[model samples]
Target: MKIAVIDGQGGGLGKTIIEKIRRELGNTVEIFALGTNAYATASMVKAGANDGASGESAICFCCKNVKFHCIIGPIGIICPNSMLGELTPSIAEAVFNADCIKYLIPISKHGLYIPGVQHMQINDFIQEIILELKKKLTH
Candidate 1:
């Protein structure tokens, strides 16, 4: 299975997710780190992504071309003008239109409140994602 991990800003979230995925899944899944900037991509790549790419064009092309089993990222990936506008409209559109399931981590952002999702640590969210992936990928 192929999973795309998308992030912007400092890419810390993406890096952590990639690391956890690698530790839990081993080599069972291929991970691609898709970032809005080179620094973000580099961060995930250092963590253990099989490959990575940056920028809106790369994001659009990968979302359209890659047959990813899942796309994992913050909820911002679907929101236009997010990540201090690093995530362009085209990137958001491509991610929303991608032919893959998405697992978004609800973050506490300015003026955004995801109802019913209590604020949790990033580690907790990562654990949940790992559990979900195990349930789906093992079957």
Candidate 2:
């Protein structure tokens, strides 16, 4: 299965999620790191993403045109109004309009205030999503 991990800014969250996915799933799944900036993409790549891409155009292009089994990220990834240059209405619409399931980590408005740090335990959420994906794929 192919999973896209989207992030913006420093990509701390994306890096955490990517590492957890790799540790738990091993090489059983393909991970694509879609970052709003080069730093974000590089972070996830270091965390073990199979591939990585950056920029708004790359994100929009991938969300609109590529085929993936799932998209995993925080709510900001789909918010379109949060991260600078990364989250746009078009990108959000494309992700929401895609024919794949999405696993959105709960993110509150206040959570956005915290810069450079991930406020939530995305690893746990990713574990749940991975379990669900495992069940679905096994079935």
Candidate 3:
């Protein structure tokens, strides 16, 4: 299975998620680190992603052309102008329209909130995501 981890800013969140995924699934599934900038991509690559790419074009292209089984990242990924304006409108639309399951972490930087999301620690959310991914991959 191939999955993409999308993140912006410093990529700390993506790095943590990728490390946990590596621990849980090893190298069985390909991990693509899709970041909004070079620094973000580098951080995720160092954390254990199989491949990495940065910039709006790369991300938008991947979302459209690459066949990812699923995509994981903060909820902000589908929001244009998110990540302090790093996420562009085209990028958001591409990701939102991608033909893949999206395992989004309910996080927002500019007051966007999912009404049903529970109040849990970030690590807890990541663990839940790992568990769900395991189930999806096995079947």
Candidates in order have lDDT scores of 0.94, 0.82, 0.92
lDDT tens digits, residue span 107-137, model 3: 7456876676667878888999889889988
Backbone atom clashes (below 3 Å) for every candidate: 0, 0, 0
* C-alpha-based local distance difference test score of model 2: 0.82
lDDT of 1 by residue, 1-139 (tens): 9999999989999999999999999999999999999999999999999999999999999999999999999999999999999989999999999998999999888358877778688788889999999998879
How high is the lDDT of residue 4 in model 2?
93
Q: Give the true-structure RMSD of model 2.
A: 4.2
lDDT of 1 at 80: 90
Q: What is the lDDT of residue 83 in candidate 2?
A: 74
Q: Model 1: runs farther than 4 Å from truth?
A: none
Question: Distance from true position, residue 79, model 1, in Å?
Answer: 0.5
Output the better candidate (1/3) by TM-score.
1
Off by over 4 Å in 2: 110-120
Largest lDDT belongs to which candidate?
Answer: 1
Would you give me the overall lDDT of model 3?
Answer: 0.92
